[model samples]
Target: MSDTQFLAGPALRRLRRREGLTQAAMAARIGVSPSYLNLIERNQRPLTARLVVSLAEQFDFDPRSLRQDEAVGGVEGLRRRLSDERFADLGIDRDEIAEWLAAAPQAALAFARLYDAAGQGQAATPAAIDPMDLARREIERWRNHFADLDIAAEELAEELRLSNPDITAALTDRLRQKHQISVRILPVDVMPDALRRLDLHARQLQLSEMLDPASRAFNIAVQLALLEQRDAIAGIANGAQFSAGQQGGQGAQRAAWRLFRRHLAGYFAAAVLMPYGRFMRACEATGYDFTILQRRFNVGFEQLAHRLTTLQRVGQRGLPFFMARIDRAGQFSKRYAGASGTLMLETEATCPLWVAHAAFDHAGRICTQVVSLEETPGSPQRWFTIARTVEGSGGNGGGAADAARFVVVLGVEAGQGAALAAARGVDLSASGAVAIGMGCARCPQADCRQRSLPPRGKTLVFDERARGLTPFEFQR
Candidate 1:
């Protein structure tokens, strides 16, 4: 077990209740006293490695369940919501918020939704909610892992014998044989609007000629998912608790549901391309070498990185990673927190000091950085981040091609950094780490030369007599 403390009282209580065992009965089964188990269940004491292993062995539960649950809602999300100017007078600390989250996660999630609604200046009606935000919330709710999809994809992968070298041919053959859909690669001039198009009348799946091998295979897998995994995807999407109060724009709600279903299909596609069991074993063997994994799996950097976040299978878990994709202007296009409790994705704009921004300077090269975030006073959260630029699917067309370049960043807790091949020999210490914040608008670092905006809820101090390193100086 890792040295990190597992203070998950709610998870333990939930597991105990699910198993229908009292505290004393659970304690006796796990060889611990009822008082000790009570302390663990109340977050007063951390679960030791022995207790975790014992519980897993006795109850057949995943040991990871002993950690704080990030699936329902994270403390970071609540912290970000509380950091708004509206809640400044409340003066709630991080510890207090964490305790509240651990005690009642559903209530905390409801509070976050209410805060979001207040920020939007309206109630969170189905019509009023942003489809993208709703999709993001659903993704975060499940921690980006769909067990049913994973299992189904894994079975499909084995049935298709995806271990072969020519995955595109295999997928193409599957479509041709099973679905009677002929796979055709059309030139860009022939199919100018979209990368992949299905001509239902002709029973054909047409893909753009511009697509690379990896992309071609992915598109085919996506089509396969649409054809086969519709039931599974629909079941999950329908299970989502989307807001229905004051619903007039049913179109927007349907769009949001479709968007979430599309995301699930894409997830299933990735899982089919990279089977969970094989991918997890390879990750451990390679220490998560992105280059090696990409080559072996025949996937793009973004695809490989995205697949890494979904390795949360019970009893066969891989490292919990958080990922974000951003453009040159620092706008977040995608964000996923697969149990990596980093607050980097809370905002659209991230810290200028992060290595992700610098990735644009050195295109196609993997840039690594260890950064420290002072989310709470005197207790900094450290993360090891990897950033690389990936060419967009849009065919190379002058400045338009340059505009399509996006930087994909993958991050893990600094303690887990040593296990990654990318972070080997790099300094993971606090002194050597770059200091960044959630974003410039929320960051409190006053001395940073790259600071673009002053911290929230602070009085600005324009000192002409003695200028500071940053242009925006605020009263600390």
Candidate 2:
């Protein structure tokens, strides 16, 4: 809407054909010339706002259908796909990819699918497929939003009349009255193996004493989702095409499907705890202050961070936030990109310069940074990132040293950073930003002191007489 052209030629052509209307007839109905309509259908011209309104009014269809779905990998996604080293010599530009998407989105999607298959080393057998990757792909396919589950959770939240001060009591009482499952908090020594366990035979929901109030409520919500929203979760999971030809074996497919369903149940649990409408209002009112929102919602840091990524409901959309959590060893435990389209989330190797990695050093405190990523020269993408360390559920017996730690990092586009209270007074300008990359291998940044590996596709330079700031010296 900000003067960005909407060129959905393929969609328009398909709509006209589906309606059995000739170009001239459609043009007349839309108050545009036949030639202009042809141009629009062929991707030579963008759809005017007036024409879109007229088409919607005359056709009685939603205007949202004219735009490409983010799930099919929009311009940013296609650009990332084209940046692969295999296509390095192609020298394809962003504008051409954008036009290609508008002209033939199905073909673009097909290309993306082929790219993904090739990345998987052309797995011929079902057993060769990685179930976890399949689950992650399903989540990314929908941008982490499950509309049906969201609505159901919102309704359930309202019926429960959830309040932050006694959310645990409310959930426990609901489980007890509705499902006849009583909640019991067991001592750590008694239930040392698991945090939360449901005994269907005993009609008891046992929770380890290790869990805090937030976690207790969360586990209860998860139980409720599995019991109440099982059908909805399964319906959503069934729609995911984990393999290209559904060739995966039953075991592999079941593993992927179960993982996907578990994540969906968690999504429903978060939605019930933090209903979309109320959460959106709180986010806007508090300027997205994580601390205040966490307290207000009675949720933990990770729960709040995960919920922030799913605020993509239509007409009440929140900022497109991408989240990632990593341990001290730089291993990513969780990652979700809710339409932010930042390419950094696509890879596991994270740059050490990122504040998320630095958050481990400054435990229990929030760290904010404005970083720039130049995937290509002369076009830098900026992001405002917030990172904070959370105590992992390693049990009290492990002590502080044995207890694991994780850094939850949330990021949004720098242009929207001003809306976040944490980014206030932080310079969002390009010059003030710390230039980071995907990782040492994929990064082309020269002379970075923290770089552990040479950049990919660069020739290593060896000189006995001198050494640079970084350990590896490579050709730029």
Candidate 3:
């Protein structure tokens, strides 16, 4: 494709505007220059491989977005184009071409334009659609389903603690004794045919066809419940609150309930493995150390952190706390809480200052940091928060079993330990309690270098004379 035909100039411009970045700001992020970026955006340049990766990381833009060609301008064909007959006589060395791609993007774009139009001015074929976007949507469906299952899981977790002490092992055993079935993973190609039995035997047991691994695990887990712990599982799901669609109609709500039920079964399994009272006692004894808990209980960090939030029940509640798990790039993997007052609706995605980022830095190191937050009086109700980062391993070989670094955070009212630790006199300054933005919009503290947008429910007052320590202006 010709350079002009494929270069997605409009979308690139829009993304820059949305991020509130000028060409110079973008250049600083990707280590380029204003004039160079300008030339590229104006269809005078083509993108390079290294720059493509840089753009993806810096702006958090999807890699697929740039590859759209018609949307962000593809530059992969630049090298071949530069090696064309038009350039052969020009004596442009490959080293010079590579250097221009990295150092002088403007010149590279100029070359791309000449080459793109040289051969019949045809445009390159558009890239395939992003699987991650679809994956994200699917993931969201699963998440909302889990959210709906929260109340049920909480109850089952509690019930299993009181009654069926070893749910996971017990369930695993039951499946073995009754059905004569062995657990095994089959490849995707054969999975659909391998588990071809969706046949239900009197509601006590059933098989599902063509289920994904996660979905299959859930179906089997649920069947295990019906076969062995029917009374308890039913009691939990039946008694838990169901919002409209969760009553089993078609849509996201019903999906959430099903996911929730499946998740509840797992929670029951975990609770069976590490009963609540026992786990809570271990936590207190170890000063909330994750590794010690993991070793003591034979559970993973993600499981341990998740179980921590579920430690709330009548007469058995631990200190009320919120829990979130984030990776090195600030991707939140899990969020859960039994706290009544804390707002825990995926808030981690909005707050980057929380120590979660630092957790991915150095593996196996626990960092205890303080956070300072303020409640808002605006329409949506917001908070300004400060957090600390701790690092850990993601297991080995970078697999699911790999030791993953994770961050845990709790909402501190005025007097919470983590909160007080961040107060002016509590002495957490050595722990790096720098102020940061919250959820993009809800953050109230201004003068923040991290401010992506004006704080919600507050007016933006630009101050040229006396800038607050943060970066933006704030009002009472």
Candidate 4:
């Protein structure tokens, strides 16, 4: 595979982008000029052994994996259209053509524009997506869960408050006593053999399944959490409800139920780990430092971020917050926060100022940032984002080709001001400032550098002579 013409420029670009790296940044990591790297991606030049080795050594990437070519959707079909005519006389090499297709994005765009003008119907388009759709879907998942358990969790919270600390520990002991189950770390090879099971006869509860060590540990932690904080978990879960009229379409009602139930369970889990009062106290103590929260709670970045949203539990509320989670390539897997109705999750996009993406720039590096979204309401809210490259379970040689690492971000609206200024006693607008839209479809911002598409619910007016920042003039 190493000696084969298997490298695809788009594949490489995707990999680099997923890692939140630019061509120049990647070149620096591998000791190559950005131009040389560009050529390699364009297929004008093949990657040398030195660069290949550097990728493996620096980022723990496999050389063999880099040799594999990933199909470039939309672009390939367009290229094949002119294949017969473009190089019929030259006898062009297939690899060379692929290189040209992958590396020359600008040329490809020009071709696509021309093709579109000619009514060729190119596959990919420039119109950006609305991320709110994605967020809404995720919120739906949580909403469904919470509906079922809302009342249950709330009732439990008050009742459990009296005995939470003791009950939590006792529950941990109960799982152990009932099943003789104990948490143990095992090598990766024997992880699948680690199962979560009960030995009814011998009264042994064991975990024997080949799981990713980190995930396995977290699951165990969550299980312990269930026992220790059931009451508090229930309290937070049931505290909030959108509206109860039993008056929606069947599909709408069902979706609502599902989301509520899911959110209930998630809230319960969070409560067990970080009780409402305790969490609020910690935030005050640490000034909302996400890393410190991650360490203190022994949870993943996304979990912590999601928990931040639920801080608004009745009188003990902290702030109105918005949370987002994205992978290295800025692909959003999970997103839930307040303001779901307004924001768009159309594309798996990342803010350039987001630090979660930067963490992937260097494996194990923790990057934090406080940036303002351009279109958000009021003053720019302060967001604390963290990123890192983590290995996934399973490996096909250099681990697993499917292993994916993601970046996680959590943010709070400026009830006071930007994160820093507020901390320093500067007054920041809390009410008017809200998260701006990611793209035009969900965003109402007039002139945004990141606007790739038009706002969804706006009237477009064409005035080429006096065009604003957006490609099209729009009415609010």
Best by lDDT: 2
What's model 3's TM-score?
Answer: 0.47
Residue-level lDDT of model 4, residues 26-144, one tens digit each, is 99988989998898777667766666667777775555455332212233323332332222234444445455665664465456444433322322222211223322433432422
Candidate 3 lDDT:
0.47
Poorest 10 consecutive residues by lDDT, candidate 2: 393-402
Using Cα atoms with residue i matched to residue i, what is each candidate's TM-score against the true structure? 0.81, 0.85, 0.47, 0.46
List the lowest-lDDT window of 10 residues for candidate 3. Answer: 125-134
Clashes of each: 0, 0, 35, 51
User: Worst lDDT window (10 residues) for model 4?
Assistant: 122-131
Against the reference, the lDDT scores of all candidates come to 0.82, 0.83, 0.47, 0.50
Query: Candidate 2 lDDT (Cα, whole model)?
Result: 0.83
Report the Cα lDDT for residue 144, model 4. Answer: 23
**Pairs with backbone N, CA or C atoms under 3 Å apart (clashes), candidate 1:** none
After best superposition, candidate 4 residue 308: deviation in angstroms? 1.8
lDDT per residue, candidate 1, 136-213, as tens digits?
Answer: 767877878999999999898888884454777888889999999999999889988789999999999999987888
Model 1: worst 10 consecutive residues (lDDT sum)? 394-403
